[model samples]
Target: MGDLYSELLVKRERTAKDSLVKYGLIVLTALAVFAGLFITPLLLIAAIILGIACYFVIPKTDVEYEYLFINGDFDIDMVMAKTKRKRVKSFKLSDADLAAPLNSHRMDYYNGNQKMKVLDFSSGNPEHKRYGVITRLDGDTCKIILEPDEKLAQAMKNSAPSKVFLD
Candidate 1:
């Protein structure tokens, strides 16, 4: 049989929070530079450092989540400004205590659990199709939410037949 592999990339829209952060950093960088110019030359070096740091940090404000399912292993990565990619999380589908559609009742337990840590890698919009997987991380139950296409969904089901639910 062919290897079960699939990939899905979900771009996250720029939220008001992201815009505020981006602009706030810019404003701070500008203020530092101006303060250095008008007050003290010593502050100029700090301002230059701040400006350079902001240059590298700004693009990370925009991000997309990529889901990769190969065989039974599932991984979610963060893609920053279409440039940098970082592995955010990884787990075997078979290890998931439960996997189901976002709105499915099968997820209710993990969703309602007070101790479960919820990690959202989805678009944060309910209109988009997403799935919820409950697994363990560092001895704590963690609920991961991500968008996955048909191929990945099928692969998930194939890996963990009893635990995965699409309907």
Candidate 2:
């Protein structure tokens, strides 16, 4: 059979809290600039710097997660601002100790364990369904949270029937 290859890109959605924070920063910057204009020219320069800082910090960033499933291996990439992209993680299907829906009871046993390393590759939107992957690393089962497409899930199940859990 030919190798199975699939990719999915997930974009992050802004939260209400993020909007509130951005607006709060803008209001504070405006207040600072107004006060600085009335106080001193030096103060105005300081306010300009503050405004620039806020501009870089408060803007809602666009982040996209790229998931690639090739054969039995899964790779995750993080794309920031539509320009920067970096590989986040990669794992083989056979290495997974447990793979299940994020809300499934199959993850209950490992959820509370503090020793396991947890990596979340999801889009950060709670509305999107995610999957949980537990793989053995350094004698500990590391938890990986990801959003996989249907074809990727099928490919995983076909490669490792005993480990992949879709329900």
Candidate 3:
């Protein structure tokens, strides 16, 4: 049989908290610029520093996650500002203890465990349904949150029958 390959791209919705932080930084940068103009030369230097930092940081505020499931291996790539792309994480389906809808009871056990590190790669919108994969990462058990389409979910289920849930 051909190897299973499924891909899903999920755009992370910006939370109000993220918006606040991003906007706050912008406002602070503006204030620094204004202070620099009227006050001291040092303030202008500070403003320049802030401006440069903002140039690099602002684009990072918008993010997207791409999930690739190929032959039992799952990979998540982070896309920043629709330009930069970096691999976030990758794991084998066999490593998962269980895969279920984020809201499903099957996830409760992992969710309650403080030691279970959570790696969220899903869309931030509450209205969207996300999935969680309980797997080991760096030898510690972690819950990988993602938004996988039906095809990707099915491929994952097929790879690990005992571990994946359709939901």
lDDT of 2 by residue, 32-100 (tens): 788888876667776787788776656435568899888888888888777778897888878888898
TM-scores of all predicted structures: 0.90, 0.76, 0.93
lDDT of 1 by residue, 96-128 (tens): 899898788887767778877989998888898
RMSD of candidate 3 to the truth, in angstroms, is 1.4
- Could you tell me how far off, in angstroms, the CA of residue 49 lies in candidate 2 after the best superposition? 4.8
Question: Candidate 3 lDDT, tens digit per residue, 102-144?
Answer: 8998888777888678998988776787888898999998888
CA deviation > 4 Å runs, candidate 3: none
lDDT of each: 0.86, 0.80, 0.87
Model 3 scores what on Cα lDDT? 0.87
TM-score of model 2 vs. true structure:
0.76
Question: Using lDDT as the measure, which candidate wins?
Answer: 3
Per-residue error for 156 in candidate 3, Å, reads 0.9
RMSD of 1: 1.7
For candidate 1, the 10 contiguous residues with the lowest summed lDDT are: 107-116
lDDT minimum window of 10 residues, candidate 2: 54-63
